[model samples]
Target: MKLIHAINDLTATHKDLLGLSKQKTEALTNNKLDEFQALLLEEQKLIRQLEKQEKKRQEVVEAWNEEQEYSVDSLTITEILQRLDGEEQKMAEDAAITLTDTITELKRQEQLNKALLEESMKFVQLSMELVNPSIKSMNYGAASSDKLSGRSLFDSKA
Candidate 1:
């Protein structure tokens, strides 16, 4: 059960990371550099937290295994079984609760990131439109005028 919870927590963290990456990509595409930087910082913090949690979980599992190994030789088999069962049950319940909380937090962060990305994109698009009315329709083509003579290539062609 503890293993299940650890896997769930890791999965939730991965989902949050994916959402963050999506937001960052959108922000970059829309030219929201400031917001992107802020998101990146938040992502780094979350990653650190996830790493810490994973390490702690591993330690707990290792400790539990070591206790089980020692108990196997010192205690009757039935007594050891009961103890292990109790510990496993407790671990499962705790893991479930932790995983649920982690998932909820991740979802909240994802929503916030999505909103920020949308706002940034909207702001950039509006700003661009306001700054250059024809920006959306402007096309890049070969220059009609010669750089040195300032003469229209079209005129020479004609």
Candidate 2:
């Protein structure tokens, strides 16, 4: 009863997370820094919410285990499914599958976003390098250093 509700809630939260991940991919692709920043904040909130929901789910499962007097130290979803029968079991199994699928999709989206960010960073670095070329180290000899020294002009003037 309560466990099923908790599972459903968690599944819903994960679905929300998956949706946000999709939005993040769009924002990343479009180069919308502001939208991306907002999505990040929203993601943090969802993560916090997810943590609380997970804790609640664990508590409910532990409570169920205690109620049933299951001797097992850890009660996983599969183990819980064994005790459950009929509609509740079916609902829990469905929720688990959906959650797993959503998580997989989220990971894929995150990978795409990561690649986009890396490419954007590379482009920015290239642009900066073009604008201001960095000086290469002159390790051939002291003559190379002397040629680069500003003191030479001062010395010539003096």
Per-prediction backbone clash count: 0, 0
Between which residue pairs do clashes occur in model 2? none
Highest lDDT: give the candidate number: 2
What TM-score would candidate 1 get against the native?
0.43
* lDDT for 70 (candidate 1): 57
Per-residue alpha-carbon lDDT of candidate 1 for residues 1-158, written as tens digits (9 for 90 to 100):
45546656776776777678777767766778898899899899879978987786676566665765753323332343355556665666555566667677667767766787687779989999888878336543444223536655466652
If candidate 2 were superposed on the true structure by all CA atoms, what would the RMSD be?
3.3
Residue-level lDDT tens digits of model 2 in 33-122: 999999999999999999999999999988999999979888878889989999988988888888888888888888888898899999
Regions more than 4 Å wrong, model 1: 67-158
Pairs clashing within candidate 1? none
Worst 10 residues of 1 by lDDT: 72-81
Worst 10 residues of 2 by lDDT: 149-158
